[model samples]
Target: MTEPEVSDSLKTFGVVLKALRDETGLTQEEFAHRVGYSPGYVAKIEQGKRFPPRDLAERAEPVLGPLAAKLLRAAARSLTRKVGLASWFHEWAAIEEEAVSLYAYECRVIPGLLQPEPYIRAIFERRLPPLSEEQFESQVAARLARQSLLEERPNSSFTFMIEQALLERRLGGDATTDALIDNLLTQGARRNVEVQIMPLRQEDHFGAGGPMYLAETPSNQWIGYFEGHDSSLLQTDRKAVSSMLRRYDKMRAQALSPRDSASLLEQMRGAQ
Candidate 1:
């Protein structure tokens, strides 16, 4: 079978990876042994015939030190650049990377940042129009890449207020839902991340406006982002952003506390 062409971004990533590996003076076979991959697989990754796995970057960190992390970030950004994410979302994505503080109120599904690989894959598979196999895989890659932000910006504060019903709905079935809950609990444990669950029984809630994302930029300016199936709006107007911020604050107040949320997740996981 003929090999499919790789994107320019991936090719650039390959070049960077190769350069980093060469700087360590390790050949493909040696580096493969160090990284616990086959020589051929390493060769394919460097040749841009294959994309590097997220775990590969983690494993490579011990061998290549901080440079490996930089390489991973660069590769992730490259993949996202070519993944063809919705145009309306591009600005939010860029802003999200530099956010000093992020607050989210989600009613539909788990926020992408906290979703596990299995959960993410299942979500994509259930899309209405049904993404093509290639499209599905690319989207999965991009979403996972975006997740890197959680780790990359350790100083940033992230707060997610999720509806209790969404978790109970179990979008990806038992096993996937279990994993998702586990992941959420793990992330919630982070000192900088707060995960709160809004009870299903709450009749009056501030997040009735659907899912919203609010972020504090590096300059301390606040912005609000809202998205639907095909379009998104970035609110820079002070009044709009302030209104969304107030709603998020109220949502956080009404939702289960982080400690209680973790308990709920544990209960859900055990039930699964």
Candidate 2:
């Protein structure tokens, strides 16, 4: 596939390869020798400028062996399964499974990490392509499974800065929105969760452009994710990540603190 369709998968593969190399403490030149690729070519692949060919995969199998390639192939398939869903999203899903901290800013809707199963199903039910009932249930289940991160022991630190307009959007109508807000308030009460609300009238805000999430891996590497209509981008570029971090900082500054955010949700519930 061309770069546009397969960009995320290629990058994910690069991450896997680079991790393996780092774990083995092999210099690019040395690793390239083991994998039978020119060091320059290996470097390009590692940098996500090129995809690994079948020949390269074969060469890597011996050094990385079957177990690593098996996992990578599974990742490759998942990354390519949904055309509009970028490969980076699959990798992000994997990262979410092990993340130590997650911070998200949303302008439109609640973050998936904070959504309930019924609400997620309602969101899926509104999709244009119209999923089969079975598919819908499966997706809802998968989305709900993600919420385990909030409840699991040693839960990852979760923070959300959401615009007030999102709460007013009334997705699935007033009752559903109320229920969703109640759930958010309840989840926010958790020891690991910090939820903030940015009022509509706030001025000099950050993230006025769109939504973004910054995740910190267990090892402390930071990656940024932003979604578009048909795809999402996982940005590992230090500069891009830094810019989002700055914007999130600004949003946090403009938002109600977590304690008051929950109070706002309660007040909105009463007003409804």
Output the TM-score of candidate 2. 0.69
Candidate 1 lDDT, 4-77, residue by residue in tens: 34677767777887888999899988998887665766776677655565456777888888867676776766
Off by over 4 Å in 1: 1-80
Residue pairs clashing in model 1 are none
Candidate 2 lDDT over 1-272, as tens digits, reads: 11222357667877888887777688998988786455755775676544454344555677777776676566555333322332445567655655678889998678987886557767888887897776666556556645656765245688888888988888888878878898999889999999999988986876767999888875687888888875788889999898888888878988999988999999999998
Residue 207 lDDT (model 1)? 77
TM-score for candidate 1, please give it: 0.72
Lowest lDDT 10-residue stretch of candidate 2: 78-87
Model 1 Cα displacement at 41 (Å)? 26
The global C-alpha lDDT for each of the candidates, from Candidate 1 onward, is 0.80, 0.73
- Candidate 2 residue pairs in backbone clash: none
Model 1 clash count equals 0
Winning model by lDDT: 1
